[model samples]
Target: MPRKAAQVSEADKHAAEGGAVAVDRALFLLRAFRLGDTALTLAELAQRSGLYKSTLLRLLASLEHARLVVRHADGRYGLGPEVARLHAVYAASFSLETAVMPVLRQLVQDTRESAAFHVEQGEHRLCLYRVDSPQPVRDHARAGDLLPRNRGAGGRVLRAFAGARGQLYDTIRREGVATLVGDRVPDIAGVSAPVFGPGGELRGALTLTCPASRYRPDFRTDVLRAARALTETLGGSFPFDD
Candidate 1:
């Protein structure tokens, strides 16, 4: 006989059925947009969301009516300004700075370089917390800015450590850290390492930044130390090569 499906509790079944199925499916479609994908064609959205075109039409109609999604002049669909407004509200209300800013501050004190924590936001990375170096000459980046993921050390570190595989990511997986020089800007350099959760999942990246010419041998080492410390504090372990 075929195996029977596991039984669900009465409470669980009630909770699962409490919400409208249409709402869940619509939300799934919205989540298909990742960092770097500012706009998507209808066909692309259908493929990424695993929904049929006819079904997408119905869903997109509802979403568009609510200003949750917009169709541009070029016929591509993108998130509407409503999404930005919601994100702004979320950013204003939710922050981990109280918990992690002190750690970033210490990293700055140790390396005398700007220290930051980054989190993946779709195809981009967001600087969630940052502490600038006291030196008059320092690199510039603001918290909450969405930065290109392929350009900076923190972005690459987030990708490599979070399971995107490649030659560079393979090396980062083994070493637990990443370094970059003039990758994003001609005069800025960075060292980055992964911070993980207690379950060994990626939490974010801890990065140190300084002028390309001023980056010293110890800068990378200090970033590694700070990353490890932060990971441990969050109940996670920094993986190292065997």
Candidate 2:
């Protein structure tokens, strides 16, 4: 008896599907670091990436040897310096800053509050650009500040709209907008929204921070509107489900 051509083709198709699944699992391991944690234990990584412990250990060993992941003295793992170098290479090749600078400045001017642009930096979020309010008593945020993704309004905004699922991400996503009543600084309030790029990928967040006393009932609406306007200007798309 001879096998049919369809049977051979189906076998080949199954092999290809299996390969793809493996690749997806590997990528999921890398993505586990993006949840704003500085480091994760093996068990935590397994739970987050949905990989079996045995599989994750093998993958982590390979990644660690390749300098993509590093194991800390405490037996936790985090992205290695090599990953930062790679990000620097990619950032140098692209110009997200050039594209969004004018919009950020406009947002600050229109809102009369401090505005900043933040992007995910390994296990944290980094403020890449910021504009201070003209008010003498205004809050100030500086560029190059690394913030925990769960901390403030800007961080929550990025986590929420980016479809992240940790406690911080879940709470913000459920709320639609992030509001901070002094999470970052005493007496300072902030609001933020996620900025998406092509293919609905999270690019960063556009945020406004001010004194808590200045926030009114309409502040959230204003921030949302500004974020939407910026999204349109940049030809960015977001998930309709969010």
Candidate 3:
């Protein structure tokens, strides 16, 4: 007997034909630049993006004209000034961190523990904002770091509010918080609670982390209070309070 044909959804069919090929290829070329590779030769771009040299050159011309990519004096191409301008504008307009940083710093002062705001990114979570503990020895996770989203208190809290079905998540959802000790990092304790947006959707997680030695049973009260304040500030209602 012959093997059955694979199924193709109508959405996939529409996506395959509706998008612009040139625009997609140009974006592929731009995304080929990673965190550390500041500049790339034409050959390097071709190799990394798996595009032919001729096709890449054609795409690069348009990109360079739009200032989306630029060539240096050394004949290597990198992201252009437009990207930096776009980033600056985005940072200025998106003031979530600015508004939340004061709250995070206040939490750190109150609890003397590192505080952070985390947002899920696929299978990982990104630290969007962080305030370190005042202690001489403290945990050292920084903004933009990608960490596993299935471990740590912050991850569990986000996962729970995102509707992942499990006993652990169920308990977290019910309690309005999650706690982890020696889970994501060795000898570290963390407590996290959900932050929500105006329409009550999960926005991010507010987490407090410190050495396991500093883990106090009453710390949950502070964490929960901070989460509630942040939720209200963002025009979201605190489910636990309701």
Candidate 4:
């Protein structure tokens, strides 16, 4: 069967790329209910999700049954109590300890390099969390280390998203990642991407560091994906290049 043609929202694009079309589309609907939205009608959902009314209704039925949505007497819908329950569950465990460590670990596992979360600290950057490479040869930075803010991939990301104007900053803001070689310490290279907070504010930079001899340009993709994951986990929207 041919898929119907319609305008695709960024969330919808994410859903399509995620491979599980039905589940992602259902999530696409839930996400359509934004802040200050108490309720949404069928047409509103259809308009936002880019799904036909029939498909939307089916998804809504499943969502309603799962207590993820509620149908009002006015034929409108609102999020159900389960969402609050889930939020409570998430809130109880949401922290850098629970949220960031796993991503850093996986990043190290993927690239066989070091991964760290860097935050802007006045004139410098703080390594808030780090996972070292399994390889014997690597940089020796650890968590809580204060690194330079004027150079390095992580610093560039912090400066770029914070609106530092220049060609280098422009590229980082546009691509949502920064890859640099020997910007700080000699023989060190890194790729970093911005992680956003709940209000879409720049929270920190997700960085992957390796010896210049082993740095791969492809590290940018891993860094960006890790940053995007962390952004969404922190309740921020991960905006993509359109």
Q: Give the TM-score of candidate 4.
A: 0.78
lDDT by residue (1-242, candidate 1, tens digit) is: 64442563222233335687667668878877876787999889876766666768888899999999999999899998888899788667754666578889998888788999999999999998999999989988988889888778899998897678789889877787788888888889988888887568898988898998898978777888888878777756777621
lDDT of 4 by residue, 94-179 (tens): 77768889989989999999999999999999999999999999988999999999899999999999899999999888889888
Q: If scored against the real structure, what TM-score would every candidate get? A: 0.59, 0.55, 0.61, 0.78
Name model 2 segments beyond 4 Å from true: 1-94, 162-168, 238-242
Worst 10 residues of 4 by lDDT: 9-18
Residue pairs in candidate 2 whose N, alpha carbon or C atoms collide under 3 angstroms: none
Q: What is the lDDT of residue 23 in candidate 3?
A: 74
Report, for every candidate in turn, its global Cα lDDT versus the true structure. Answer: 0.82, 0.73, 0.86, 0.89
Tell me the tens digit of each residue's lDDT in model 2 across 35-66.
Answer: 35899999888667655567678888878888
Root-mean-square deviation (CA) per prediction: 13.1, 13.1, 15.8, 4.2
Cα TM-score of candidate 1: 0.59
* Ranking, lDDT, top scorer first: 4, 3, 1, 2
Q: Model 3: clashing residue pairs?
A: none
Best-matching candidate per lDDT: 4
Residue pairs in steric clash, candidate 4? none
Model 4, C-alpha of 37: deviation from truth (Å): 3.8
Question: In order, how many clashes per candidate?
Answer: 5, 0, 0, 0
Candidate 3 lDDT over 131-161, as tens digits, reads 9998977789998899889999999998898
